[model samples]
Every structure is written in C-alpha cells, then in structure tokens.
Target: MPMLTDTIKEKLSSIQGLVFTEINNYPCIEVPKEKILEVAKKLRDECEIDQIRDVVGVDRFTKNDRFECIYNLYSHPLKIRIFLRVKLDSKNPEVESLCPVWSGANWMEREVYDMFGIIFLSHTDLRRIYMMDEYQYYPLRKDYPLMGLPGAVQLPKK
Candidate 1:
C-alpha cells in the first residue's frame, strides 16, 4: 500500500470529484466522470479494495445534465471500503465496464444502464433486466412524470 498523505486526500477531495464521507469507520470516495476508471483502478490496485459489492445509478434530472453512477468496493484483506461515483451526461452516459476488474459488476452495471439509461461502455452484454422489452424512458429519472402524459386516456372508474 502506498503512503497516504493528507495532501493526497485533500487533492483527490478537491478535484470536484467523488463526494466522500466516512460512514461507520469507512472512507468512501467519489470520482468525477473523467476520473472514474482511474480512481477505480487506484482503489483496487493501490488501496486494495478488491471486492465489488454493488453498482447502481441515480437519476437526478433536476441537475442540468447527467445521472450519477455509484460503485461500492470492499477490501477483504484490508477490511476497508470505498465509494466511487461518476457523473455522466444523461443523453449518452457511458463508462468502461468494471467487470474486467470485478466480474460481479457485469450484471449490476447492466441493470443500472437498463433502468436509468446509463451506459456501460465496454460491457459485453448490456440488456434490459427488470423492465419490458420496449420501454423507452428511464423510469427512475426525477423528470419522468409517471402519473400521466398529455391526453392520456381517461379510463372509466368502476
């Protein structure tokens, strides 16, 4: 493990990248879009975060443009944890699949892409999981008004 410095921590924190927090004695880190993969590699190779717990996407349309991809990694040997986040453009959010590093990420990333419209760039098979085959809009987006659309058919009540 490399020597961690306060400067390095502050530098990574100040990059406008990776919102971080210490939860229950774990240091969680978030990385910006451009540094997502780089940070992930570091977490695994340098910091020894070798376990992939989950990958998920959050749709926040209120923001100007993009969804946030959340990655959770754990180090079995070191007993440490990390949280990685990447901001991607909503229109075409994409990232290299982390499956190459952690096979567990494959299906999780795909599910996130399917539901939130985020794309995993190098995923071998990115397909819809829970939703219907032809569903278009991302159901999780804040702006995805699900109640009704203009001129929606008004069904008679019983």
Candidate 2:
C-alpha cells in the first residue's frame, strides 16, 4: 500500500493548490477551499474513488485557519482509502458542497454544518440536521461550554 500511496502522492503533487502530508503513515492531501470541487471531480472520475465514507470538521482555534473540513474517500476496486482536507477561515467557514460529486455527502455535510457551523455552498438543503432550527451555536467548537450554555438549558417552546 505504501507504493500505491507514493504513486498517488506523486500523481497528485502536480495538481495546483495541493499540499501532501501524512497522518499515521497514511497519505493525506490538503487542497485550497476554492479548488476542492475540482479536486473532488478528479478524484472521483480518474481515481475510482466511489465512496465518501465520512466528512469531518475540525476546529483548532489556535491555528491561522481555525477550521478544517476533512473528507474520507474509499475505492473498493482499488482497496484503498484517501483523506482530503480543506482549511477554512475561522471567521467564515464555508466551502463548495461535494454532494454533486457524491450524493451520500448531502447528509454528512449537513451534520458537519450543524456541529461546526461550516457552510456548504450549493448544497440543495443546507440546514441543521441534528439540532433544532433555532439553535444558535455550534456545539462542537472548543469554546463551547462543557455542560451547557445558560440558554441551552431552557426547554423548547411548545
């Protein structure tokens, strides 16, 4: 698998706005937010990545771009998995939706948005899936209180 990883790294390195890194020995690619849709199209059309296993959002408040949207993709025929990441500015964490590339990403992107407040551009329905519509804050951020906020304890109005 290392050979395949190296080959993929070599192939993707030439793509503009792509930066490669390794996590737990697995190759991960970082792409500019504006180029994510183009990159996803390439990964799906050319690399046989058929499944988007997961979409995760991370908030590292100390970093320059405090938010990251991560995608885990799998190719069953190739028997390989790949990670793609896009760093987003803390002030406006928004990126183009991948649901166009992978239909399964619709709900996954909503979940990330609900938890991390990251907006998905061009998503058919970008709304809170887990939390109520009136919920005001993203719960997964590091700054959120452990127990609950003052207003969070109030029961929803009937």
Candidate 3:
C-alpha cells in the first residue's frame, strides 16, 4: 500500500476550514475546535480512518493559547496516521466532543478532561475518569504543585 503522500496532504489542506501543518516532524492538521466534529466525520467516512488511537493534551503555560489538544487517528486499510490538533485557551478550555464521531472517544475525551480540565462540549457523561470528583486542580498542568496541593488527599500513611 502507498504511504500518505503530498497529494493526500494537499487534499486534507484543501478542506475548507483546515490547515495542514507539522509538529516535531509529524504531519499534523489544525482544526478549529468548533469544526473538529465535522472534520472528524469526514476523515472517518472519506479517508477510512477507522480508529482514534489516542487523544493528548499539551500544557503550554507561557503561550497565549495555553493548551493544545491532539487527536491521533489511524487508517487501518491505508496504513496511515494523521494528527489533528486544536488550540485552546487556558481559562475554560473546551472543545466539541468527538464521541459522536467515534464511540471510542468517550473514554479518551474523559481522560483529557480529567487531566487537563478541558470540557468536551455535549459529551453525554463528561466526568473525571481518574481524578476524584472534588479534586480542584488539573495535576498535569505546568503550574500544578509538584508536592500536591493542600487539603486534597495525600499519599496513604504507611
């Protein structure tokens, strides 16, 4: 099978509201948060991207946007990988949920929400998957305390 080529990249870039770019040598496309669901549906149906491999969040504390959410997708038949990124502001970071596109995204989106405090708008059951319901801080943030915060649960006494 042929690998993802320039022609394919150009086709993706040609999508009305998407930008093809790269990050750390990996080909990436930035999709406006509002358009993520639409673009994701197209990629799944047209490109045969069968799986959402992972969803990750980066905390760029110093940057004005402050966070980036990345979606890693794989096309099983074509043997290709694509990365979709969405930049979000630090305060009240939120993006449309992908659960409607791929059911597997339910847990992945919840994980991102748990660690990064980003809301998946319209998610049927958005909640903390790992952290406690009352935990106040996003532990993965660059500004979170290294020693853990006061009043939150501490390590169990040995």
Q: Please provide, for model 1 over 1-158, each residue's C-alpha lDDT reduced to its tens digit, 9 standing for 90 to 100.
A: 22333333644553554566554555656566776766666666755668899887887764455688878777897665566766777667777788878888988987897778887877888888886666666667777687835534444589
60-121 per-residue lDDT for model 3 (tens digits): 99657898899998889987787999999877799999898888999999999899898999
Total clashing pairs in model 1: 2
Model 1 worst lDDT window (10 residues) = 1-10
User: Once model 1 is optimally superposed onto the true structure by TM-score, how far is the C-alpha of residue 54 displaced, in angstroms?
Assistant: 1.0
Q: By TM-score, how accurate is candidate 2?
A: 0.91
**What is the Å distance of residue 135 in model 2 from its true position?**
0.6
Name the better of 1 and 2 by lDDT: 2
Candidate 1 clashes between residue pairs 3 or more apart in a chain or in different chains: 18-30, 18-31
Q: Model 2: per-residue lDDT, tens digit, 13-52?
A: 6578788887776678899999999889888887778999
TM-score: the better of candidates 1 and 2: 2
In model 2, the number of clashes is: 0
Global lDDT of each candidate: 0.70, 0.89, 0.84
Candidate 2 wrong stretches, greater than 4 Å: 10-14, 153-158
Cα error, candidate 1, residue 12 (Å): 7.6
